[model samples]
Target: MVLCHDEIDAVNDMQNLVAAPSLRVTTVQQSSHTTLLLCSAYNFYPQQIQMTWLQNGEEVTSDVISTDVLSDGNIYYQIHSYLEHKPKPGEQISCMVEHVSLSEPLVQVWDPHPPRPLTERVKIAVGTFFLVVGLTALVVGIIKNKKRTAALCTVMHENLVAAPSLRVTTVQQSSHTTLLLCSAYNFYPQQIQMTWLQNGEEVTSDVISTDVLSDGNMYYQIHSYLEHKPKPGEQISCMVEHVSLSEPLVQVWVYFHCFDTGGVLLRVNIGALYLQSKVYRIGQLYMISKHSHEQSERGEGVEVVQNEPFEDPEHGEGQFTEKRIYLNNKLPSWARAVVPRIFYVTEKAWNYYPYTITEYTCSFLPKFSIHIETKYEDNKGTNDHIFGSEPREEETEVCVVDIAYDEVPERHYKESEDLRHFKSKKTERGLLPEGWMDTQDPIMCSYKLVTVKFEVWGLQTRVEQFVHKVIRDVLLLGHRQAFAWIDEWIDMTMEEVREYERATQEATNQKIGSFPPAISITETALPINVRNGPNSAPSTPLSTEAPDFLSVPKERPRKKSAPETLTLPDPGRRDSIFKLPSFFSWNSSPQPE
Candidate 1:
């Protein structure tokens, strides 16, 4: 039978197989003295299956135990083995069963009571204690971490530590707007502010917007719209103000474009001012501008006038075109004063007008005279009233008037032939005379008419006229010396012309002599004449003459043996008609004596 229960109370439980000779047992609810066991006995094919208890080698069987064959086709036999009294320490109590198929019976025995409850209770207690300690430590650790985080936040707030960094994000330019996206970092849980400053002044409104994060950090996106072009020197600064930092952090960026001035940009030297495109004297700054009247006016008005006309209106910027002048070390005060102003055209172009004045002293001339005489004779001279006088005394007198002129002589007149004669005469005389006498001679009185002319030059007319009349009367007196003075002036001028020509010729010759000749020394040294002939070999001497040794006479005659000596006629004793052979004859041999 199957048994179902919520719980089982047992010290031990045993079940035995009838045909298979196996047994299973369970022990429960037995604290002492009770044991559950199984036993089996085996004989032959018809082996008897039975259980028996042995106590002290004696079999004890009880009726309270039940035995049967299991449904699994195994032989089982069971019998409870109990000691009538508690089992003695040395006694053996066992359950034994016999099976028909085995030679011996199987037996199992155990004490039903055990101390397992005390061991299990101790294990459960230890596990529960460890679990409680682990949970408590985890809770304490979590609380400490929370406190530390709170302290760190407090310290960071006190120190005002904020992360300051900048990065240029997206830059967008639309039709009229410029947008910038930026993120800012600062210590959280505090009040911090950001602002934009344009050239040191705060800009609060008209900037786009700001966004704050859950952690008290902020993201700012700004759009700045421009309605007009920005002026030069205008600047924009991103100014951030926060409680986390002591001072506001400002980043400023300036915008400007290069400009060209349409003026002479001079390379300025040391100790000089570059004005009007030229380096000018420091002292002459005013005078350089003064040369241009328009520039002078502009310089005077520049200080007083707030809005001045642009020097070059077309170019928008006030560009002054420059001019250069090389300065002299020494300059007059007026020139120095005016140079600086006139050096450049401040208003307009400068007009330069130079004025000059000259003085001349009057020269005085002394008195001078000229005289002229005319002689006319006719065949009826005694009856002519024009020459009324005795026949021999009859004469015609003509006084030639001398025009006296005083003033500067005309330029053409001074360059004319007459002035050349006058100047030449003055050089010869060294000085003008106080007065002069003129005379004219009457010739050919038989039938001739003679006329004489005289002229007197002077610085003043009255003196010259008085002198002329005197000269006229002198000439009318038939004086012959007046013509000589006139001829001297003419001759002196001709000599001057000749001298000038000669000097010119001498100068030309000197210039010519200074130059080297065209013919060079190297060319002159070269041989002009070249010989043309077949190259001849040097001549050899003729052998027709005697050997040189024989040509020379010896001082002494050669010695000879006494027997070989031959007597010869002495030239001194021989007759005059016979000629002796020379001592150095060609056929002669030395005599042996």
Candidate 2:
């Protein structure tokens, strides 16, 4: 029963026949210099209309009050809006009303200068009759008065509201401490509020804000500073509130943590992808921590080179380590044809239990990097604002990979690794049937934000897409294996797990290559595109020296088309997880107790 446009209009007409609104612009004396102006639209049909107050034909936003549409008890409505202002000479105030009944907006203007009293008019007429010869002198006086009125109006217009411009910057005070500055300028009115937020939570301590200062013009400016030590994957923002803005202005400052490993300074670029890990309680965390290490040690296609544990003043309570995953012969034939025989991707991680940050970088591709920020919680993946309140600059697309239902790669799939076929003997948590996610108990989810960047022009989109596929595969394979091999680490203590890491790291390093180089490396400024503006470089990471291993080859390899770039084989029955919509039903589930 779809109605045509004409029929819809006819129905609307029958329900709410056109009735234009009556508008009025009136003022009340508040003080000797101030006045309250009200612009009201009355008795409009359909209860929908718009009313705005304007000065000199420009719409006003500040010091305005409005009333909701009140019922006239006859199926009609009325609304009022007000603007309080100081009386200014030569200024024209108007009320603009818009409704469906009116062909165009109706504007009723109020004249500042009104007619004089009848006595004064009569006296002026008598004088004019007697002094007819002096009419030229009167006309010259009138022209001078008009010129003065125009000049006054120009000055009044200049003194109206001005919007503010905001800028945020970072300053490095020491190796680990950073200073963030948020500044807003060119705004009229001295009143403004500025505050600092870390991961969307306001920070009252260690924050300093300057008094709103005049800019010597008719505008105001203010500066806010936040002094802090660096932490992994922290988002700091400065929010400014002013009467000039209908909503508060927010400026985000993302903190990038840098640490030295061998002769390389690793700077992590932050990104996020929320992935679900359906497991019970602490078992989920242990499985993630231990299985990741075990997989690296057991893999044949890749080798784990260096695993160095380090201490940092900022992240003292957490585990800080650097690792290198050497990809020598693992590259596809097409990829191997265009690169050096020796190639590896560096992996640096800061593990703080449920909160962890891992970054991957390729020495050869200076413009490419992968950052992953992970947060573990004992609930369904519903905490949308766990990362930050402000929306990210990039559009976010969500992918839910059903480990049991989604198909796995043929070459890597194992009968033991299949979640639908394998069951755990000790925990009795295996042999997950179809739609098992609906009834899974004591569920926990791992929210991962994976950000990948490839700045090369033609290869950017395709390469990024491919890398995400590989990441999703890695996650899918790793989690599936974790559950299948749950008996291995379900009973290990924290100390035992640490000892296991030390032993396997040694064995893995021996299998990969010789000991890593120990040259000193200095921090460097990120590329201009990564920075917010010219002054965005924070003090701590002013500049970074290239790693020793990133030396230029004697010859440049010709660029080749990426393998499977033109057309990739269908991965599985389900579409690639990247192509999925923005959300899943499970994402809206209630927070787990």
Candidate 3:
């Protein structure tokens, strides 16, 4: 026992002797073509160490030189590494050091931008001196205005609790109607009232809302959805009454000619040439939608397995298209973990101009599907019973997304694309300032009724919620892109737009196919029922048989809830929706976004 204790003490003493490294990275030499960076580590003990260069998180294999660790003669060591490379735009260069003393790798980044010049530094110093002097004089002035300052503080305290941030966004859209979502977020005291008003009158019907819900941070959020069929010269807005505001806050809905699909309204200046605008916007939406799918780097991404645009006399007038978005590799990490590696979801759309019906179904899951009905109108979104005489489900959740005011992912943000700052020179429109919706002329809204279903018991709620989030993101991004790139498509003809879509879709399909795990194309006839008209949902499949990886498990049921042993749904059942197991009822209401 004494020997063991002595060994432990010796190890502890050795650990105590360890010294962590101090790193300094500098641009040692520079030329027009290449720059050399030197990274030095000082005063690190326990001689064994490793040093390397990294560019944007990846290891730098070439153009690297390292010096052997040298003793500092005071029980410490020093090492230096050199990296030489041509500078690339937006490339981050870093030096990584690993040693026995470090709990994790030590990194030092090289800043390409040089330190401030002496004159610039002197100017900043002078500015600071004047700023301090001004502050001192301001203090004297504040003493004379002490009573006024106190009154201002009292007003601030009375008004500055928490004011709700408001944004109106389109949750769903079709040919002639829009479903608008008005959301109020991050307010305190929990006493707030919201109302939808059209043309200065309080709207009484077709409004669905969520009760105020706590954000768990002493703040609350509520969402209200207004279904409206927009008309010419009509104004629609959300009125919020909160204690933080001295007066009620009003947010008007702005319907810009952001997208020019069939039923969407446009300014009369263009006259009958509006069809060109509609075609142009459709092309823009397709391109933007395609770009969103390419963000995933883990898999091959989305593939257009089949795209068939046809005309149906039964559906009346406009075009009908069936698109298959084969998402073999284009799935979120959470979904990809459980789904078969090779799977796809089918989309069928019946575009009848002012009204449209779109449906989504997954082949492998069989029980999961999404159905959406959309209508467009010339006024703010307010349309009730547009779908059918059937009463809409009261539990349906409405999410409003404001493209101009709502926050998008920071990585995707672009200054030129920001609606608050961007203005269209050709149309003399945009630069959408606060309350821009109140006065913007030629307004329209798209109303969409979305329904999602997942019959698997354990995964139903989670999957449905995830699908909604994904849908919202898609809608927000698509609308933002349409507005931002309006100039590119505002003048395109219908034929020109169709050609652009064809070329882009071909390029996108090629890009997905070129990725790892080579893909082969096969032709198979879809069921006749899949080609059936707009009223019925169809079970469409690219292939009849499941891949070998999707074969059922042989193990007997042992009370496990997984669907591994379950048989795939019969493709013959065309009209029947997947029913939930009687024991499992999904009563969970949708959460507000």
Candidate 4:
């Protein structure tokens, strides 16, 4: 059966086969040559292929290069060849490939031409003749058709500018129809009027708002809502208009329907078209409609399923967390009251120990017994009785009996009872006072009397008999505290010293005379003397020249003198006229003559 033209066209499109051979033609400019030619073919096998280059219908030799067959099972292959030198005059170079079921091999040819030579005078004469004739013809054409051509060209160019390029993005599809969203870009402002034309009439009711360009330039975009079940060969168009354009630009969008088992059968197809034979900027979007033909034939339907939820390990419940500490109670009431007082006394004793205690005695006897008596014989003698001694007569005698003694027992006593017995014996023999006793007693009297003695002895024994004796003493509580005060004082002093050093260094490093020298009284003494009392003449003015009239000094207003006092002559007596003496030389000289 003979197929219709559409069916034949479809069949030809389905063939999906193309073949091209590698054509290598070299063009050399005395010192340079072109590279090899590479070509490709579709729906062809290389093993069943033959490639060759023919020069003037003769097979090329070894000097002309060629490549091996490269292909897959499909109708696609590529190969390369090189020509060694530029072809001579009238030389024809062709690459040909042979295939099965093909009456003729595919051929591509490169024909080279030699340079033409002409005399300079003849060339100039020919150019002048052509120039005159071309100018005459151009002038005649313009005179004959100037207005018509200008109007036609203007209309054509305007139509090209207004022509719409359509693009459709297929958002989603349903069983009845495919949902398509269409957009157009690069449209001029004058061509922004858009309408959806169904069949031949304009569609105006279902229009959405148009989006104008934000830039001050001329451009706009508009969207329209369309719902239709498209069939094969159905025509739909998006038309645009602008007053500036001579003719309206129209873009026809053709719709096609296809069938698939899982989807509805609705498709829209669009291709670009030129108007007025001028170039137009067009964009297109296509939404393809699928039909459920196979499913309908088999009596089956397709279903969509939702995805399951996912759990992330990073957000799990049993993750590593930080711990915080909470304090349930503040300082105890007893401690709050006592700690401050204790700290104060201890601080005071540490500051004033040396000066407070002028004499101290430490003694150690048999059986590892130890005694220490600190006689804080105050310089003012307030605690002198505590040492069981009279007030000293002199300041120098206050420390006169300061003694420290240590005696290591041949054997150490294991228990406090043995130390007690030894201490009792020493007390009875007058080696120690009757009040002296071991410090291991709970009575207050025992502590006040003997605890001090034992502490002194312990310190002495540790110093002389034991491996370690660590002694730390300060003169007075105030003296120990003074050390801390002195440290602060030293720091402040050092800071002051450093600041002074920095100031001196800055002054030394600066350039000499960068600052004016300070005025001294001796240097400021004036060389010129004036009659004004006490005050000296003012210093020299900054400028050397006399000032202009506008800046000159002005005169001060003169003060009026008091009227002269007059006295009346006594009573009513007549006043005699007296004349002061003047030299009489002129009268005497006349008399002598």
RMSD of each: 70.2, 24.4, 23.1, 56.8
TM-score of each: 0.16, 0.40, 0.44, 0.17
lDDT of 3 by residue, 138-167 (tens): 999989878765654433334446899887
Candidate 2 runs further than 4 Å off: 1-316, 390-396, 513-593
lDDT of 4 by residue, 307-367 (tens): 0111113321110101111111222353344223211000000001111111111111111
Relative to the unseen true structure, what is the C-alpha lDDT of residue 547 in candidate 2, on a scale of 0 to 100? Answer: 41
Query: Which of candidates 1 and 2 reaches a greater lDDT?
Result: 2
Span of 10 residues, lowest total lDDT, candidate 2? 580-589
Best by TM-score: 3
Ranking by TM-score: 3, 2, 4, 1
Ranking by lDDT: 3, 2, 4, 1
The superposed Cα distance between candidate 4 and the true structure at residue 559, in angstroms, equals: 99
Clashes of each: 66, 14, 27, 30
After TM-score superposition, the amount by which residue 587's alpha carbon in candidate 2 deviates from its true location, in angstroms, is 23
lDDT of each: 0.27, 0.52, 0.55, 0.28
Error of 1 at 273 (Å): 28
Query: Model 2 misses residue 188 by how many Å?
Result: 77
